[model samples]
Target chain A: MSVDAATVRRIAHLARIAVADHEIEHLRGEINNMLAFVEQLNEVNVDGVEPTASVEDMKLKMRDDVVSDGNYAKRVLANAPATDDGFFQVPKVVE
Target chain B: MNAPVRNPKLLKGDKHDWQVVIGMEIHAQVTSNAKLFSGASTEFGGEPNSHVSLVDAAMPGMLPVINKKCVEQAVKTGLGLKAKINKKSVFDRKNYFYPDLPQGYQISQFKHPVVGEGIVTVDMQDGSSFEVGIERLHLEQDAGKSLHDQHPSMSYVDLNRSGVALMEIVSKPDLRSAEEAKAYVTKLRTILRYLGTCDGDMEKGNLRADVNVSVRKPGDPLGTRCEIKNVNSIRFIGQAIEVEARRQIDILEDGGKIDQETRLFDAAKGETRSMRSKEEAHDYRYFPDPDLLPLEFDDAFIAKLKADLPELPDEKKARFVKDFGLSPYDAGVLIAERETAAFFEEVASGRDPKAAANFMINEFFGRLNKEDKTIEQSPISAEQARHDRRSDRRWHDLRQDRQRPLRNRLGRGWRPARGGREAWHEAGDRHRRHRKGRRRYHREEPGQG
Candidate 1:
């Protein structure tokens, strides 16, 4: 699969990245190259192979239902750009 | 009452009859002590951000670990719905941007869900039932709350609810009317509560529904459907469907086509307004999450969960009718809540089943409702009723005396009949004294006192 200019713009928008109009073609070419490099796997013939999410053949790890963490609101919001009353504050978002 | 019929005449348009179709997607918060992927407390009404963890806050280098109880809850809910539990399901990242979602994307299921198709049989108020097909059930994370009114030019975000587990149960477009939609949600909530997966509390925002509504002429093809989002109450769900259907019909009759988009229901105005147009539809751009592996379980795991399942509402209702000889209406009232059913069973054991049902339904529940108390908050206990059978008589007397308020009667303390017990005790003493006298005359055993 190859990425076109429009696809690049859409991706940038979805990722919340501010991409300039002049750089769309360059990003498209860069993305297409990446996709082509990863497309080498298409050469292999493994029709019956199962699709797996992880490289390791292991199931997801699950932890017991216990409340072992929390109550450190100060540290959680310490690095926020803005905070008020222990809440992360942002510009008013209506809707 | 007559059985409910799916009458197409119910939705009559200006020129022709129309049929309103509805489907629901219910988001139920998983009842867990901790967050789904973090060890943060999932307690409701906590101080803002007190339950936030590094993972929930999306801090750099922080990872999420799956909570076993949330997954188990999803599987239990699936079994309750009689749905197929997928042995392997993948978590996908649905990319979106909102202030409440610090991750800039939601970890959800798209291509592969935890549960597949199932059917839910909803009994209508008119003594009829219909089956609504379950499209799928998926597990996802809930977003934080964005309080817009906190400030004049800014919003505050509470991450207490972030990373909490939610089950998104989707249904097929099988509902025929607003009543059917309401009944469907009611039944779904009851089932979820019975499974102990979700509390199904709409007022607390534990359960919310997105209703899809479309209208088409009879025997015509399906029309473009619009979704009414985040309807929090069952009454509002019914009203939303009716309002959206009327809106669609009016547009179609005026030679204007329906625009498929998302709309928000205004409960105060009793109408629905478009939230977003189809041209600006969301492009979620879903992809598998690299942080977590595929969730896979074996047949043995499913069997264990299935075996440990409690008798659901439907089964308990059936048993109440068949074994206790209760009318369908009476049985329904009894099994509406799990606690109420348990209380009824305790009161009915080793007693006349029908009479116990009548007493509990007519007298017990009636009095509880009058006092605005739930079954758990009942003043009378099942053990008290079992030992003191006169409570039934007291209830009858209370019912006869309509002037006496329930609070007054209860405050007076519906005590057991001490007079009868004292009388029996006195009679027993007199008989024993007589026997002792006879014994003294026959065998001279007066010293045996």
Candidate 2:
């Protein structure tokens, strides 16, 4: 699949990334080249093969339902830009 | 009784009668000790951020491990609904942006859900029943809570609920009225409670629903549906569907088409307003997650879970009708809650089942409601009720003979049993004397003067 300028703009907007009007064409071309390189796999005739999420044929690992980790509120909120009373604070968002 | 020729809930429009179609998406928090993919506590009402693990906080290089209990719970719920449990299921990342979502994308099932289509038989208040088709059941992680009224310029974020496992059960558009929708939720909650998968506590937001409603002519094609999101109570769900359907009918009657969008139910104002238009809605690009492998299980695993299943509401109701010789309505009311059904069974054992049902439903339940207490909080236990039943029978026989008055039958200075009618009458007299706003039943001891 090839990417166009309009598609690039829409993608940028959906990702909440800002892009300049002139940079859309360059980004579009770069995306198209990457897609073309990945599209070479389409030439293979691999019908009836089950699509898999991981290359490794391994089962999903599971853990017992126990509370083994938590209660380090200080460390949890250490990287937050803002906090108040053990809670992360952000600009009001109501919808 | 004969089936009605038409549904009584059809709305009369200016030129024609309109029928409302509804579907529900219920999100029930899985009852587990830890979160779905992290080892963090899932207890409600903890200190903010105290339940957050590194994985839940989305720290760099933090990996997610599936919780075995959560998957088992989802399977148990699927079995309870008589749904198809897929041997293999995949979890996908639903891409979106929200302040409460620290991961920016929620891990959910999109194309391949864990449970497949099933049917829930919903019994209406009028003794009629309808089957609501289950589309699918998928597992997903819950987002953090955002409290908007916490501060003047900032909102407080609580991640205690983040990463909690939720089973999103979607139903087909088969509900024709608001009452059916309410009954459907009620029945689903009972089933989940029976399976012990979810607590079904709406007060703590453990269960919530998103209702999709549309209005169409009696025999026309389906109309555009507007989704009312995050309705917490069954009563509000009914009101929201009615209000949204009326709004659509009015618009269509005026030659204006309904705009499909997500709306919010303003319970205080009793109306639904648009939250976001269809054009501005988020396009959730879902894809399989690379961090986790596909969930695969064998038939033996499903068989083990199914064998451990408890008797569900429908089965219990049927048993009550056939074995206990109870009317369908009485059986339905008794088995609505697991505890109530157990209480009834305990009292009915080795006794007249019909009489026991009548006393429990008419007398015990009535008094419980008057005092605003549940079966667990009853002043009298089932054993006490059984003991009292004997004395009550004797009193009935004495009154039936008509040869002597009750006072004379119980000769002078001959005290009745502990919970006999005489003691109850004395307690009632005391209650009237001390009617100073006490809520409990005041009973005197057997030997007390």
**Best TM-score goes to which candidate?**
2
TM-score: model 2 vs. ground truth? 0.89
Minimum summed lDDT over a 10-residue window in model 1 chain B is located at B440-449
Candidate 2 B-chain TM-score: 0.87
- TM-score (all chains, Cα) for each model: 0.87, 0.89
Error of 2 at A23 (Å): 1.8
For model 1 chain A, the run of ten residues with the poorest summed lDDT: A50-59
In angstroms, the error of model 2 at A21 is 2.4
B1-449, model 2: which lDDT tens digit per residue?
A: 11224465789988789999899999999999999999999999989999999999888899999999999999999999889999899999998877778988899999999999888988777667778889999999999999999899999998899999999999998888998898899899989999999999887889999999999987688899999999998778888999999999999999999988899999899999998633443688888988889888889999999999999999999999999888888788888889989988987876677767766764666455444356786666676566553533543343233365533433332232455445445544655676654332111100010
What C-alpha lDDT do the candidate models reach, one value each? 0.82, 0.83
Q: B52-103, model 1: which lDDT tens digit per residue?
A: 8999999888888999999999999999999999999999998888888989
lDDT for position B391 in model 2:
39
